[model samples]
Target: MKQISTILFSTVFFPLLQPVWDKEPFNISNISKPDAPFFLEDAGIKEQGAYFRQLPDPRIKSRIALSLLKTNNEKAVEILENMLRDEKNDNVISDLFICMYRLRDKAKITYSERIKKYMEHQDQLIRGYAAALYFIKTSDAATILTMLEKENSLFVQELLWNELASKPKSCNQEDLKKFLQSKDSIRRAGAVRVLALASKEPDSVPKLKKAAEDELPVRIALAKALKEMPDAGNELIAKLAEDKSSIVRALVASCAVSDKRLKTLVKLSGDKDWEVRRAACETLGGSKSPEAISALLARMNDNYEPVRTAAEDALVKINPGEDTIKKLTEFVKSDAHRDAAIRVLGMLGAKNSALDILNVLNGKAEDETVRRAVEALGRLECKSAADAIASKSSSKNPAVRKAVAFTIGRLGVASTFKTLELLTKDKDASVVLEAINAMGLIADKSFNKRLNEIVKDVKPSTSSDMRAYACWAVSRINAPTDGMMEEMKKLFLKKIIPMEGEKTYDADYARAAAIMALVEMGGKKNEPSMKAAKSAISFFHENPFKTKDEDSITLKEYMRQIQAVMNGTEIKPELVPTVKPELVTGKVQ
Candidate 1:
């Protein structure tokens, strides 16, 4: 019974031990090298090497064959070669032959011969992999692909098609030419990529143009391909700008931006899709064509910020002259415009007339009025009002002082910057803090060192404001820092706002300043803060103070400031739609 058990165990387990035995006694140094057709009878090699061998089930055989190829073992090839004789396993053998083709370090004659057998394989996968191997492993120009004519599977055909398209030296140009005009879109599309890559054959452009009319993806791919050729497909890319697909239109716009194709892209600016409009704006900006300015300006009313911003940006890029400046200047004053006007004017660099326009800011002086004026002046470098602005610095009014300091800095001149420095030393802490902020705005490269010096000298009482403004100025003048953003929000949320405080102009100014700061920051982070600003705006608009004049509220200046920040419009709560003339005449609400 023991002997029978031993024999049974040996039969199953002896093959597994063969590799160990072979390693011990099979020293190749003294023995002659084994010839081909060697078989690894070891159970481990038999199981693993079967991957390269042809088997009845090609799927299982292919998976295993891939593993054997990875081992790069010489005996695996012998096992694969023997499997090729079985007709049922021809698919597996074809795959193994392709693997053998890849064994060569170079695309030499040996590799091409091994890959050539796949052209006769009945299976499309075998034929596809074979074609891939031939194109990738060998550079023989005469291997004009003849198998693509017989390919049946769309996927395998795509692979073969790409091989022909990409490998110019080895591609069958005549076959590819015929395929470019094939009734099948896929084949024709593949041919386009192949031919366009090979040569911008003028004759091929007509086929691509025809294909683009019916196919969207191929049109875009062809557009991109044509963009690279010398005037290669400029007309085609321009024509694609009118494509029904917004994605295609956007790509064409992008291409237009790169190629300075303003004429065609301008027509796309009115695309029904906002995305296309935005892309058109971006393209116009790059084109820098004067004709695009009006189109971009028209798009400024787009509901989307990206579109509006792009349009405004494009206007500045194309025609940043008197017309664009006038529109921006008027927009900064328009209640209907978005807060982006501040950026528009800043980009305009029209700071010279910043203070001059303050005289026109007499429209119910809301904090928005003062804030936008301040930002515009800061952008324009209107530093002439240093003394007048400084005198109001300590007028026992935080709003007036904040506005004055903001304006002084917005003027962007070092002369007014000194007044800000003096205000930082005022007995009133907020006054002193606002002064430090003014220094930040006048980020005249000449005062960078001085600003740094004063930033360090800020007292502990207002270091938070100083640090906040210091970082803000640095962001405005240099690069943005995470600290600046957080501190700005903190100051706006806590110190720079009056959520439900007394109706003092200072309280109003503080709230308005907070709104302006948040708007200037310009991102989703300000969503909650903007909601607060809206509330404050509504609060003031509903309750009017007693005024000597009947035509407008007594606090026109304050109203104007608020209105400016609220985009020059007030959202008066319906409860008190308009300030009654009798209310400001001392009659109770």
Candidate 2:
């Protein structure tokens, strides 16, 4: 018997592994050398060597190397070659070479010798990449076949089969078909991956039908590959609905999010195993179909709390019926789901539940419950609860106070302007900052008198972030341009050169925030606003910070639209989903 790695093959129940590039929880900010792209574009080539060495993320590091190598600068190429000589991190080397291999020309030519060595490495990941880079390039079929015979990892075997199937008018059909019957389950699963690419219905369908019964792993792999072979794959994924092993069935729950498989997924919601039912319920949460709601509703009473909660969450996500709103309102009475019920009702736009949610704020609820209730009422736009929300502006918890400030702004209750102003003067910097934002959202010209005070306070005594938020707040309120535009223009045009006593203020953070504010302030269609916007855009050209904050990255993506609004070509919508300011604290992009 051939020995197989259980973790690699996932012989037991485990979530399928996506390639590293496909994984999440990584963002553009995570790039250690964000200027790598800039270096590739300009005279920064010499500077990139140090940036590349200090860089931490492997995916970004690889791209930087590819970028520099693409520059064809002899110095850039020579620097990378020297770095690779001592590069001990195999992942870094493999990522670079794999990306290069995909380029298929100049990069592959330059890196061939080193990659050939990767082919001989014992690690299956390295060897798989090497084979795809080196071995698959050979016109000779026997050499590729010999490597396939010796390979053990399912991942590597899948890559090889995909490579072989992609070669036009090539690959011996009979030889590839033999793997479907191999005792090695990996080979059989590997065969399923390419069945969509290689075979005709008369031949492929029967082989898959037999392979379905071969092993659990094979059937699981078949479900994942269904998208590639829609014709035959659809029939196969449907058949997987009743697999004896719940693990195989659970794997298909995600597939059931599609209309084609949704009914089968709804059936899985009633699965005896709570895990299976939870999987189905969670997957159905993403579907907009009303039928998904009915299936999830049936699971509301599941004996397993997680399964029941999953059903509850699914209902909240799908925004359940009016009757369900009454049910959720009742859940607010119990401690077990009070916070969650308030959150669900608020997000579901449950206007009727606002009264029950409002009670949480008035009663002896926890700080967290109060915050959720406040936010829920804001989402429902319950103007009647504005007085109750403003009362919490002085709450002991800064977070609750912050929520109150944010909600008051969203409700835009002019009567509560005094409450927001009082909160802005509160001692806590974060709470005070949020209050200014709330005041801006109200945007009544009466607050224009307060603008001069906020402008004067943007000094060394204040923290950098507070100053940034204050600058942004005035722009949001669109305060009078007479005396204010001069100050705003000065800050917008000048860089934060960092005074000696400014211990708390970060010049860089303030700098980035100022660029954003000036752009927004410049965006009005009037001549004064157009001049303000054009001057700011010119200042940005000269002062573009080479390395940027995460916030700056988002602003750059919208530079064109921001310019359009400034140029009076496109009217900015009154409210749009993507362009909205951070709605709640801690939810910043």
Superposition TM-score, candidate 2 onto the true structure = 0.63
Q: Please give, for residues 67-118, the per-residue lDDT of candidate 2 as tens digits.
A: 6544533445445544565666777776655544455443334454665666
lDDT values of the candidates?
0.52, 0.63
Using TM-score, give the best candidate's number. 2
Model 1 global lDDT (CA atoms, 0 to 1): 0.52
TM-score of 1: 0.44
Candidate 2 runs further than 4 Å off:
1-99, 102-127, 134-146, 152-174, 196-206, 227-250, 256-260, 270-279, 286-290, 298-341, 394-399, 425-433, 446-455, 458-463, 481-490, 493-589
* Residue 297 Cα positional deviation in candidate 2, in Å, after optimal superposition: 3.7
Total clashing pairs for each candidate: 32, 0
Top lDDT prediction, candidate number: 2
